[model samples]
Target chain A: MNLALVFDLLLALMLLWSAWRALAAPNATRAVVMFIVFGLFLTLAWGRLDAPDIALAEAAIGAGLTGALLLDAVRTLGESAGADAGGARSPWRWPVLAFSPLLAVILVVAVLEAPQQLVDLPAVVERNMGLSGVTHPVTAVLLNFRGYDTLLEVAVLLAALFGLLALAQGAASAATRESFLLHTLARLATPPMIVVAGYLLWAGAHQPGGAFQAAAVLAAAAVLLHLAGLLPAWVAPGRLLRLGLAGGLLVFLAVAILPLAHAPLLTYPPAWAGALILLVETALTVSLGLVLAGLFLFLSGRSLRDEETR
Target chain B: MRVAPVLRRTLAFALLWWVLVEGSSVSWGIGLASVGLATFASLRLWPPAHWRISYAGVAAFAGWFLLESAKGAVQVAALAFQRRPDLAPRIIEISLALPAGAATVLIVNVLNLLPGTMCTDVEGKILRVHVLDGRLPVVEEVRAAEARIARMLGVTQ
Candidate 1:
């Protein structure tokens, strides 16, 4: 077999092994960690398949954020019942094991049976790319051609955040401490990294960096502050904070509103479209980072200050 | 009974609604009526009248936050590839300098945004975090984060 095929097989094996371990690991922490590894491997596989955007998202959101959340949940559960108390075991473990692999095999078969090449690319994407007015093909498809999906995705994110907040019912306090090394690192590294993240956001119009990537980077920074105890858990978002949350929706709505004035829905002014997209992406990065962080902290159910007392 | 802040928040929500539903042009009468109704409803819902704005503090905090997040991303990425992931798990407790509210929430949420660390709990002024690689000292990280947040909330410390 060729090198590409060999690589795909190895990745597929890694995914399967990790997934199996994640499901069967006796410890919840190990299970979560395994699942995270599975997610990373899945991203690598997607990259091999030439879907870099999906890979980036899967790595950042699926592996990184989701893993952190799962680990938090596991830690909380462990603490509540005393540190030595292991979580309850699944009663249907055997049945689940029997069924899951079968389901996976079926999925693999379906994927293999799918058509190898695009059947209507020219008419579907290339033909209508100009009409959308966005130079980026994926963005065109996401914001214009299939705008409804993008709207729904945003709604899903918002809903998930709100639902998580409702379930968790409290927030964590900030931690306070400092060391020479952390101070030096933060001072030397933070500015340049933020600049890079901004550059990535701006370059996303023609390159791989976009709202999602930029937001991941931003969220990473936010995570650092939380770790350092620089941010607090109980600080409520204000009117402007609310505005930031609603910014993306507003921009999209404005774009759609223009359609009623004889312009196509989401069609930007020709000269300023790039600038507008950049603006929207930047807003989205901040909003997304904040939303995800909020969800995690809320679910953790303790303020940073409270944490220190324990 | 405090009414002004509730009224303001209601007005803000109405404005947001208007912005969101841009093309659906209802008459000005309807918009004004809705705003008035919202304000009244909000007053009843939030019987207390206490709202504060600290713009300078928030700006400082945001500036500090952006910087902190960048540092975190690099640190976590490096940790992920380390030979001994297990040796790095550390739990640290941080003291809070701000009041229990939005600023605090922002701090904890931002912590989770970074990789390799998760906020375990927050009570009063203390914040607890679980670091994947806990061997490293977390105090400095906490101090820097606190300084930024203190600046953001206009709390002198």
Candidate 2:
């Protein structure tokens, strides 16, 4: 086999191993760490599949954000009780082992049977591209042709955030201070990360980095800053923050409402179309990041600062 | 002082409402009127000063919290399927960090929504919680929650 194919197989195996470890690890923290590794590997797999955008998103939102949230939850649960108390020794270990492998084999077989390549690229994507008004195929699909789906996805995210916020309303916030190591890491990483995130955002117009990927990176930087105690949680969001959150939705609504302006809905002014699309995507990245982060913090019921008492 | 805070909060809420509801075809007059009405209604319910938010801190905390939540979901799912029972210790207490306000109320509600845990009570900062698998270590969890609250209120470390 070629080196690339061999590399792909190796990465896939690693991902499977990490996923299994993450699921079965005795320690919750270890499991979270393993999942993060699994996410990184999944990104590599996506790269192999020539879907860099998906890879970037999987790394940022799927693995990174998800891992952090899980660790935080574990920490929250740990605080209430000195240790986990509801665990029970199992007698069905052997049965699980036997069944799991069979399930994995079947899944592999199913994947193998699926179509190996795209049969009609130009007809499907090219034909529909005009309706989207965006040059990027994925963007056109996500924001134009499948606009409703994208809107619903945002709504789902918002709902998840609100739901979680409501559930953790009364919990005492955690008091751990940012460690020196964390602070150092943030200082070293923030600048490059921000630049990279911006590049990703701008590149999305024509390439793999889009608002989602860009926003996730920026959010990661924000998370680092918060963790290191550089950014205080109680500082009220400014007008800019509000604008950023609503910007994407506004752009979308404007396009949807434009049909009344002597054109079809989402039909843009010829000269401003490209610029507007970029603007909308940028706004979307920021909004998504903010919304996701807000839900997490709101659910934890904690502020950014350290509490005075132990 | 109370009136001013209330006004500020109302304005914030109104702005958020306007951004969410206004469209390209919306008339300038309608947008303004809607914003005004929403602001007035919000102020009537809770007053302005009572609507507190640590926007900067929350923004930061949100990122970390999301990551943590996803991790939690996976861990809980795994525990559910695991064949071993590993019960550790269980304890309950009221949360002290959250203030006596809407923010605190929101926090308690979130605890119940997340998997592998449930909220028992919330008098002050002492919080009572029930975990799915109790054999794991949890001091860090409590500490993380406390930190999140501190961040929310803009308290300095």
Candidate 3:
């Protein structure tokens, strides 16, 4: 095999090995760490596949954000049960074991037997690139060609935030004590992060970034804010908070539906495509940032609340 | 909390935008607005407070910290590959003389990068640190870093 092919094989094998270790690790913490490593490997694989967008998402969301979430869970749960205490339970049981191989076989067959030429949609999308509001094919597809899917994704993020808020309200909030170190780090990092997010939002029109990756980075920064105790003890489900949760979806819907009576749903006039897409992506980034960070706050809230109740 | 740092930070962000956008003016109009919001939010969240940062001192401190941390990192790498690491890890506690702002926490955070130490928890002036090698003069290094950070923040003594 060529070097590139050999590299891909090794990466695939390593990914599989890590996946197994992540699932089969004796305790939750080790498994969680392994899973994060697996995410890093998967990101590399995606990069090798010439999908920088998915690589960024995989690293930022799949590994970084998800790792933080799992670590929070483990830390909170472990303290109560004792670190080693009942953490050895496998997420998989008999049903997963019995059904997974068949699922795997079906997936492998689907990959092997798949037609080389599935659809001419990519060619069509390329031809329509000039008419598309954005230059990036992924963005064109996500925001225009399949705008409906993105709208639903925004709604799902908002729903997750709201659901977490409901769960966190009854629980005690994480205390935000004044700490100099975290405060400084967050402050020093925030301005640059904001600029980067904005650039990503704009570059997404022609590059590998967009709302999702930018939001993930912003979410990480917000988590840093929380860690620094900059956030309030717990966010009250105030009017502003609720609006922030649904703001992206509302903006998307408004943009999508307001003109629908004149034309089909989400069919932006050719001239206004770029502006409209930018508007939607900006709103999407903010709301996504809030929702993702809200998840993080609630996760830490559980830990802080657990400590107090104990 | 002075206006100077705020202005400086805003200007710094503008420079960052240059790098991020690769000097493309096409979207600077929108990017500047985001930068403004971020600058405001950042200052609001963590004001200068009592920090009176000296640029020269900060530069010097940063240089030293980076150099020391590189050494620490190398040592840790070697230690990790050892078949049997001579174990002397311990939780050593130290109380800060610096004020209650980010000075203590900032130093603690830096200690995490300084090879063997992980700043575990802090309660007021007291710090509970986990150093990977108790034999190393990690405490001295921490004290040195803290002193430099305090000076950088214009904390007297």
Chain B TM-score list for all models: 0.63, 0.68, 0.90
- Name the weakest run of 10 consecutive residues (lDDT summed) in model 2 chain A: A301-310
Candidate number of the best DockQ: 3
What is the per-residue lDDT of model 1 for residues B1-157, given as tens digits with 9 covering 90 to 100? Answer: 5557665655675664466345345334334544564455434433442434478767776776677678788777676687964445777887877666555765677677654567888777888889866666566666666667666555555
lDDT of 2 by residue, A15-35 (tens): 889988887677777777888
Worst 10 residues of 1 chain A by lDDT: A79-88
For model 3, how does the per-residue alpha-carbon lDDT over A1-310 read when each residue is reduced to its tens digit?
Answer: 5998899999999999999888667777888889999999999998999999899778778754788778877876773442443334656566687899999999999999998887798899999888888899999999998989988888777777777767664454555675566567776776677777787788899999999988888887777666667665345657896687688889999999978788989989889999999899888888898788778876565644565677
Clashes of each: 62, 93, 5
Off by over 4 Å in 2: A62-64, A79-106, A115-123, A127-134, A171-176, A184-188, A234-244, A260-272, A300-310, B1-157
Alpha carbon lDDT of each predicted model = 0.63, 0.63, 0.80
Q: Judging by DockQ, tell me the better candidate of 1 and 2.
A: 1
Ranking by lDDT: 3, 1, 2
After TM-score superposition, the amount by which residue A167's alpha carbon in candidate 2 deviates from its true location, in angstroms, is 1.8
Tens digits of per-residue lDDT, candidate 1, A20-125, equal 7886677778787898999989989989987776786676677446876777677656633323223346577678868998999999999989886767764678
Q: Top model by TM-score, which number? A: 3
**Candidate 3 wrongly placed segments (more than 4 Å):** A71-103, A160-169, A176-184, A233-236, A296-310, B50-52, B73-100, B109-151
Task: Put the candidates in DockQ order, highest first.
Answer: 3, 1, 2
Clashing pairs in 3: A180-B101, A180-B102, A181-B102, A181-B106, B1-B48
Give per-residue CA lDDT, model 3, range B70-139, as digits (tens). Answer: 9888888888899986668999998877777666667777888888888888888888999888888877
